[model samples]
Target: MNYGPLLFLGVFLTLASSWCGLVLIPQLQLWKSGGLEAVKLEKTGEFYPPMRSGLAEHGREVYRANGCIYCHSQQVRPKGFGGDFLRNWGQRRSVGRDYLRDKPVMLGTMRTGPDLTNISLRQPSASWHMLHLYNPQITSPGSIMPPFRFLFETRKIRRMRSPDALDLKPPFAPPPGYEVVPKPEAQLLVDYLLSLRAVTPLPETE
Candidate 1:
């Protein structure tokens, strides 16, 4: 009795079953669940607000197109790794429940830039985000993040343009002659990015 054929058959069966159990089963569960809700923190604060699914969907497209996942990661590692735990990545360890709504979660594998799970709290200023998006080097002198100038418009205005001229709602549209304008997609992306704040409060030592 040759063992080679038996071994090959056994390995194939194991892989096939594992694939179905791990991949297909979980996908079916998600489909049946009609999307999962994000886990809420025990104590709420002025941190990350509830994410709009519509905005998140649009932002997902932006993330995919801009390849942000290539440089940034969404997952926070457990403490004990050199400076990572010391860094303000998150208040507590990230759990799967935190990303229940993320169909194809953006838990990237690289670390070209720091983790952005808690970026909103870390740098919540809209102006800071605008400048950084327009030109990464302006904020971080040595940053390697590419400038997303295409997402914004640069123009010189002698006088302020009416809110109706830009055809955008107030607040988002700059006052007349603002010099720079964020495209609709850029604004949406910014809104989505700003919404990525980690709402979980830091654990207190009892």
Candidate 2:
């Protein structure tokens, strides 16, 4: 009996099965279904209140320009997959609907820093984020993340320090007569970061 045909058929079938199971199936389920829901959300309105706003939209551009995706990721792995659960990044596995509105999905590869999928919920204060962006060390002492001091402006005080001025201490603080305020780009970027949170729960959890 000739085994050449049998061997070739077996290899082809195995490849076909793998492609269907791994690629085609997930594409149909995740992409097709999600694409539909995204359109429906636009037509019928969002299930949850709109979170991402104009400020966040502009801030996202600023975030991209700064290459934040290089160091920080915006995803959370499932409980069994990794330490994401232990790190308390999110209560549930991040789903497609969570980012349906995002035009340029930023599901970053590396986790050089903590996940930002739910950072807004964890740290809701705008002031805190401003301070952190100005100098990561102020919030996370000895942090490897470099300070974005260029995002801040040191201006001579005219009256009292602006309410938005950073309360940097000691070595990080501005000169005696100067105060540091986040630039417009920095403000927008922080707004975008503050908008990141898993507000819409999945049906499985509901």
Candidate 3:
């Protein structure tokens, strides 16, 4: 006759336990030791530094706004997990520490495009990134990424082209009388992409 009160108590206990296990436990673990464990350096004593440049951070926002995550995954799964290792997306599997400071990690869900975790190392030239962004086909002959031309401008060629103007060749050229110069946003985005690299050798991830 009084089973309703007992049932309510049991439900409350179950919910409390679930919340403690799911939320509290993870928070405690991640924040324990002042979170120093999450940011410890690798065996080589090298640590991946945070984004120091404002342009790079702004570029990250631009990347998110552009929905680059929909087509790309920054993660590199270990050998048994997927082809990420085989494809050389990264030198080693990504670790939690690699993204500890990411705030909102960019480890996307799909691999429509290659992982950009180490793109700065993969192609170190800013010009290449600019060309690719202006029109993917310019750098990658068959890349399906659409050109972000609005991020650039075509202005009449003055006596001297803007120092930041792209060095376009034949087919990728804008026009004889005009030159392609990346606007500030494009420059920042390129800088950000160029800054993405994993230098440390984290064996635990492998």
Clashing pairs in 1: 160-176, 160-177, 161-176
Query: What is the Cα-based TM-score of model 2?
Result: 0.80
Which scores greater on lDDT, model 1 or model 3? 3
Can you tell me which runs of candidate 3 are displaced by over 4 Å? 1-20, 33-47
Expressed as tens digits, the lDDT of each residue in 102-192 for candidate 1 is 6578899888999988787888876677777877777787899988878887566656742312333344444655656777677667766
lDDT of 3 at 15: 100
Q: Which ten residues in a row have the lowest lDDT in candidate 2?
A: 35-44
True-structure RMSD, every candidate:
6.8, 4.9, 3.3
Per-residue lDDT of 97 in model 3: 64
lDDT of 3 by residue, 63-89 (tens): 888888999888777766877767777
Please tell me which predicted candidate would have the highest lDDT against the true structure: 2
Candidate 2: clashing residue pairs, number: 0
Off by over 4 Å in 2: 1-28, 31-51, 204-206
lDDT of 3 at 7: 92
Looking at candidate 3, what is the lDDT of residue 130? Answer: 92
Clash counts per candidate, in order, are 3, 0, 0
